[model samples]
Target: MPAHDLGPTDPAVTVPEITASVPTGPPPAWAVLQRRLFDELDGAWRTFRDRYTEPDGRLRFRGTIDDRDGADDFYEAFFNWPALYRLGGADDLLPAVKLHWEAVTRQLTELGLFHHEFERGYDWFHQGEALLMFYGICAADPADQRFRERAIRFAEQYLPQSPTGNYAPRIKAIRAPHNGSDGPRPGLGPQWDDRFGGEQSTMRPYGLPLHDVPGVAEWNDLADEELAVRMGHHMRDRLGRGDTAVNLAVTALVVNAWLYDHDPRLASWVREYVDAWRERSHAAGAMPDNVGLSGTVGEYHDGRWFGGHYGWTWPHGVHSVGAAALVGAISAGIVEGDADRLDLARRPLDQVWEQRRTGLPSDPEATRRPGWAHTLGPGDGPPVNTLPTRLGLDGWFDHQPAQVAYWTWLWWFGMRQEDRARLEALRDHSGYDWTVVHAFRDKEEAGHEPPWLAYLDGVNPDYPEQALRMALAQVAHRTALMAADEKGADGKRTHETGADDGLDLHKWQRLNPVVTEVLTQLTTGAPQTLYNGGLPLARVRYDDLDAARPGLPPDVAALVEHLDANGTTVELVNLGSSRTRRLRLLAGGFGEHLITTVHWNAAGGAYPGDSRDHHLPAGDEVARSAPVQDNTIHLTLPPGRRIRIRLDMRLNARQFAHHTSPTTSRRP
Candidate 1:
């Protein structure tokens, strides 16, 4: 039986309420945050518009630089317009947005292309992606018939010619480029190969050709069924039946499923695709940087690397994997009603989070601690040069992480409240960007040229005092929300305090109390405990003992030293593996205190035997001191298992409080 089709008594079968828990009245804290966010957004828009928008209202295809003008325009327009709409409402930006839409439509019609062209250029894939954006824009704002017509036309052009056609021409052509390339070849059957002229390639679908064009009427036809069967057969045969292609194919399947809501066959395909990705991700202990329909992981053997090239990048890298996991999690929650899959989606995200927490740059920079290169020049460009590359740096101005976190917030809030709360707390405490930095460098300067550069500088200045202030603000906000909750006068629980009023006053009251207090404390300079400067801790895998232990050998004493130095926390689990190990901590003089109290599973309800209590007298080595303190902590663990631990400590007044917290409360 389908997950969503569970009987009435099933716990997972409850329907979610349609109403959102937006606060009423004037949530001063939310108002402040919103105002700040909007202010930055508005500034970003003006900067983008001034530099890219043409007099005719059509956004410029390229900035005054070397980047691909069309792609840049598409991303900026898409992110900016939809973000504005979602944050405020259509009313706030309807007019400007409409003008841009009109400009885009007119350009598409007059130029006879969905996107810009460079030489013999304008690849069909780019056009298809652009069409997808156009469709999305139309979906968000329905007033433009031309946008809809253009999207439909583009999609129709790629539909299989016959009901039982072997392959869609557009997809076939896309696979032809790598026919004999060193890269993985498409694994489609001989029929597909013969039809497209022998393109040896992996069978992963690279996100082109919209799948919802045919609608349900044609989707349920015998011809469509045959085509799906053939497609599956080709995928299994050529793609090695694995995870790489699973991500893209699954998304395609979901799009098709949405278009044919009642089709059991489509639903089955969706489940299969999701299952395959999940299985692969679990087996690898991480999702592939990218997987092909042929089941071959796309590995970069090419030596031409850039940007520290630390994690993954491009078609078969970290971003692709993260995007796949995100989409998969959301799809699984919506289609299969599987909360586990949604939780599992956090694996890849957690990988990035761990990297962030450790104050280790996800980019190759993590490899070289400091002084790797003296100057920041063009030749020293990043390996996986994507938009996030420029935005991931630590400082007052970088907004990449904030934007990424914000997008994550959208997905989490839309799907699950718990996840939303966790993400909200993470964003609030990260302190990646809280204050506005106002500095002007010549636009002609190397790093100062892009709007991203300006945005980063404006958000975070590179000064010590300013960074400290921003960091304090973040901590205050985080601490305040930790203790806040929403309740009604009648003692009824509610996400928001006020519901009937458009103002959302009650909701603000419930959420803002702690945040307000924290902010107030910070302004008065209260003490605070700063963890990795509010960044995520670096994650080291135990399998690579050397990497996990750094300077330690595979010995107990070495492990203790490593743990002590790194503020080591350990997770010991039993998976029927005979890998019991003793871990030790090195408390550097900071162990003179005891753990006063611990709230195990504070956010989530506690499990059996999960709580801990400590009452020790001062100067008692064993009782008063922890294994590690201030500088170092260590632990012993069994193999093939994991556990979470919270390490607490007291900091001086300087580290305790830096800035006033925001005037609102939140929970994570």
Candidate 2:
């Protein structure tokens, strides 16, 4: 085996670096509000990290969350990194991020990349997330293969295979292993104990501290057996219930894995599952919280939740549903050209905005519900409840906006004008413009308190110096994980990102399975409300949505003077909001490595750029900040309201010099 190479030979075909925005400025308060949702969400995320993540990055929330196993950290890192990166201005505590990523792979249980169950060491229900986490890193940091090879071995692990282990693409869905389903994918790993005595109770609680290996000191707690029976029965009825948001989320994990490396069997199952889910949503006039294999709505398990405000009934469920689908839609669309699925995705999204509901309507005559009341889930839920939600849930519940907004902004890059019009109806739906929160990911906001340090103090209240050291630890100690898809040859330009010949939005988009990381940091907005029921990046378009949203700040105006080889020129106007603090451009879509230097008129157009210009050279130590990897263009907005700012970019030089486009290059 030879080391990878990064070379650049030809430069003609590269799609040069280009970016621009229309003449725009902040709208009236009635049009939008400047709520720092990202800041709030960031604080919450950091708090979660401090409270739950061990200094080494593994989750430590004893009995809370499914995190009883290490996989929870992977789950959070996979989903939350996008928003968190933005909040931290893309400057993540790299050391923490890297350490935890390493831990997730190191701790992957016998089942592959997934963690052992808190009660049992393995469970298929927990399988998909592991793949999602592993592949995400593959697409983001392809050079590292800590778990990539192990992950591929699983291509046969969960297949709908015969006893002989004939794993091949088929026209059927894979049933959960708990249902006596097993294939010859290298026999099962260690039994550890009787915890896996029967597959029926794989998804147990924090007893014995895990589901994989039971503790001897752990008194049997027969009560847990009772709870397991109830949960088992409830889930048994819904085994792969394709309609519920949770099930849909699970499907997303499967599909995401396929995106990284197309396994035909997995691909077929994913397509079939998506098609069924789409048809069900369409016929029901909404996304169902739970549906049977036959595509009919199923019974909701209220009894299981035991009365908690969690589950599909709460706002988080709604958002998760949205996030899941958003991810599924884009991911599938790109891989399979799933226009029909993408179209179906949008329909449900519309209802989320206007109807505030996702559950497909129950058959009018099937169940008994008053005309005014709506069905929250299929078949009125199971007799038992699962989460704390059933216990404390009450009126309406709305979660943070970063998630919904994050997905929506990504959709915009690929959406058409007519489809975009549909979103006008949502401009004031919650006062979000998809710019503020996301733009902050690319900006520098000073004067915020870091209370996460307080948690480390309570043991005895450590001094401020220790707190300072803690904050220092928060700073990244390593460069980003950059893997060249193809090492350069014949003197072709190198695509090694750390060295910075440069990649662009187009190439960046091509590398990742989900939304590209470059695009993740670009999310910014102020839509009516970032609150969504479920799904990643909402899939719908409000026909009457307002376009003037995502307006400039109260004291600002802007103009896109250039985008071609002129290297991204824009004019900034203060509209007079210049109490003289700071200015940030919503740049979630810009290329990190493509940027060479940014110069602003506020800095008198100096060479090498000015500090006030906020210019960061590509591939340098300071330039390697995760914040830059995400996207941002910070500079002082002088009082008067007008000046031309020019950004010099390196362009996608190596890609063309080395790689060829579809027209010029061969894919597949």
**Residue-level lDDT tens digits of model 1 in 141-161:** 433455444433332222334
Q: For each candidate, how many residue pairs have backbone atoms clashing (under 3 Å)?
A: 63, 96
Highest lDDT model number? 2
Off by over 4 Å in 1: 1-52, 61-72, 86-92, 95-99, 105-139, 142-272, 282-285, 290-316, 336-340, 350-668
TM-score of 2: 0.43
Model number with the top TM-score: 2
TM-score of each: 0.36, 0.43
* lDDT of all predictions: 0.29, 0.32
* Candidate 2 lDDT by residue in tens digits, 1-668: 11111221123423222122211233322111111222233343454455335676654322222222334334434343432332222234323455666654444443243322211222323333333343333333323354445434443343445342322233232222221113312212323222222332432222222111222233244347554343334333333222343333334444434543556766666566566656656666655544433324533333232111112442234434454455445444433532335654565455444534223223232111222112122244322111111111243233212123433433442444444454443333323222221111101111111121121113212222232232222221100111333345455433322233332212321222111122121122111111111112211110000111112333443333333332455554444433432333423121111444565423322224456756442221111111121123443443443445555543321111101111121111
Model 2 off-target regions past 4 Å? 1-70, 73-99, 105-136, 150-245, 250-269, 291-317, 337-340, 353-410, 431-668
Model 1 lowest lDDT segment of ten: 528-537
